[model samples]
Target: MTTILVTGGTGTLGRLVTERLRADGHEVRVLSRHTQPYAVDLREGGPGLDAALDGVETVVHCASSPRGDEQAADHLIAAARRAGVGHLVYISIVGVDRVPFGYYRSKLAVERRIEESGLRWTVLRATQFHDLVVTMLQKLAKPPVVLVPAGVSDQPVEVAEVADRLAELALAAPAGRVPDMGGPHVRTFDSLARAYLRATGRRRRVLGMPLFGKTYRAFRAGGHLAPEQAVGKGTFEEYLARRFGQ
Candidate 1:
């Protein structure tokens, strides 16, 4: 049995990974901001991490900043190496290389750092999750007309799917930049917004607003899709039905 350390274990993806790993008979430890025995924050380079990583053979790094956290990734990689950990698995967004946005750029930098470290690592790139869809719905709720960025296509995935894949990676040998993981079907931001409105019985016009910059261009170019990679199971309709139970 391997000892697994999962960062951001309290979040949606992290919690699922921890539970799955625990159910698989592995000793699982979580890290958070609070000063628990195994929990610590990554912003300050995570103090007391030496004790947290005691006997840990594998690390599933699910922690991240919305604006991206390169330093946090750097620190974790360095710490795991110093602790003589066997493997490090990182969860990344799908469009890092294509987008080159600040956050995506940070992710790429972290990925490069891991590759250059000569340590065993696996980087799993996943499309946006259902949670992102939920967030969009919440935004639409505020405005009578839902203004969305134009020309962006996505195959939004389930966070659980991402977690399961991370767990699978934890068990497999480290392979850099594995096949991408995405949702069941492709749709635009407009369609997603419309689906949410329809599901919630909210009447709103989804206005496709023009976008600018590399971020917008990247998304428009299908940077958010997994063209030939792993496809997710849950459909947006299925997700809404399960979430709303109707």
Candidate 2:
């Protein structure tokens, strides 16, 4: 069995990936900021990272934040190199290169760093998660009227499916930049907000606002969509029913 280390092993996607790897009878190492024995903060380069990478053959990098991801990736690459890890797998958003947002730019930078790190690597770009879409709708519904960006759409994929794909990739040889994974449907933001309101039994008037900006324009133009690669099986309504018991 291969010894694989999963960063952010306690997170939404990482936790599921860890479980899958363990179920397959592989030695799984969970790395997080607070987890003992492997508690190393990737944002800061430290000795704990080296210990975590010890004797690890593959690493599934799932730890990420709104900021400091680039720095974290640099630390991970250096530590993996020192440990002689063979394969490095990364999960990224679909539109990191096309979208001009700060977070997307940071994700793109991490992808580039991994590509040129002189290590075998694979990167998978996926659409937004259903949980993130729900969180966004929750914030929008806080006000009496929910205001969503006009002409913007999203394809929300299930996190479990993403985790499953990562596990499969970890077990196989490194293949750089595999096919993109997208949700089954390309839905508008307002429609998704309405779905959330219905599922939660909330009454809020949803309004679409025409915002003018490069980021918004890119979103409207569907830079983040992967219609040709709609490989995910879950739907937003199904996810809502499972989450809210509707």
Number of the top-ranking candidate, with TM-score as the measure? 2
- Tens digits of per-residue lDDT for model 1 on 1-246? 899999999888999999999999999889877637776667667557877887889989888886447777777877888899989999988888888688888888888888887779999989888877878778766888998888777788888888998999998898988988988888888898888887888898888899788788878888768867648988887888778666
What TM-score quantifies how close candidate 2 is to the native fold? 0.99
For residues 1-246, write the lDDT of model 2, one tens digit per residue. 999999999999999999999999999999999998899999997999999999999999999999899999999999999999999999999999998989999999999999999999999999999999999898899999999999899999999999999999999999999999999999999999999999999999999999988999999999999999999999999999999999
Candidate 1: global Cα-lDDT?
Answer: 0.84
Measured against the true structure, the TM-scores of the candidates, in listed sequence, are: 0.95, 0.99
Best-fitting candidate, scored by lDDT: 2
Off by over 4 Å in 1: none
The TM-score between candidate 1 and the true structure equals 0.95
Each prediction's RMSD to truth: 1.5, 0.6
Span of 10 residues, lowest total lDDT, candidate 2:
36-45
Would you give me the overall lDDT of model 2? Answer: 0.97
